[model samples]
Target: MESAATDNTIWYVLVVLGLIYLIVLYRNKRATRRRKSRRFMEGKRMHDRDN
Candidate 1:
């Protein structure tokens, strides 16, 4: 019975960790995309100035 409880606790911990990992990945991807878009906008501004 104790082993069963331990297994359940481990499963819960794994699920929580997986969710945290996914959230971190999503935030990182969003940050990278935002950075890329900002860079693109800066380039466009330079092009406009050149024109």
Candidate 2:
């Protein structure tokens, strides 16, 4: 029973850590996507101006 409890605690900690890691990764991806889109828009505007 003691070993089972220890295993459970370890799994719980790992699950929480994994969730946090995924959230950070998701936020970074969203920021990168937003930055790319903004850059694309700026380039398009510049192209229009040149034409």
Candidate 3:
């Protein structure tokens, strides 16, 4: 019984950790996309300013 309980706890912890990792990964991808978009907009602004 104790072993089963321990196994359940480990599985739960692993699932939670996996979710947290996925969340972080998704946030990082979103942040990078935003940064790229900002950079593109800034470039456009500078191009317009030059013209």
Candidate 4:
């Protein structure tokens, strides 16, 4: 019974760790994509004004 409880605790810890890893990975990817596109966005802004 104690082993079962320990196993459940480890599983919960693993799940939480995995979720945090995924969240960080997703944010990093989004940031990289934004960084990659920043130049294009800047260029667009420069040309967007017909004034």
Per-prediction RMSD in angstroms? 0.6, 1.1, 0.5, 3.5
Sorting all predicted structures by TM-score, with the top scorer first, yields: 3, 1, 2, 4
TM for candidate 1 is 0.94
Error of 2 at 7 (Å): 1.3
lDDT of each: 1.00, 1.00, 1.00, 0.94
Name model 2 segments beyond 4 Å from true: none
Q: Roughly what TM-score does model 3 have, to 2 decimal places?
A: 0.96
State the lDDT at 39 in candidate 4.
Answer: 79
lDDT of 3 by residue, 1-51 (tens): 899999999999999999999999999999999999999999999999999
Clashes of 2: 0
Clashing pairs in 1: none
Instruction: Report the lDDT tens digits of candidate 1 across residue range 7-41.
Output: 99999999999999999999999999999999999
TM-score of 4: 0.75
lDDT of 3 at 39: 100
Report how far residue 3 has shifted in candidate 4, in Å: 0.8
Worst 10 residues of 3 by lDDT: 1-10
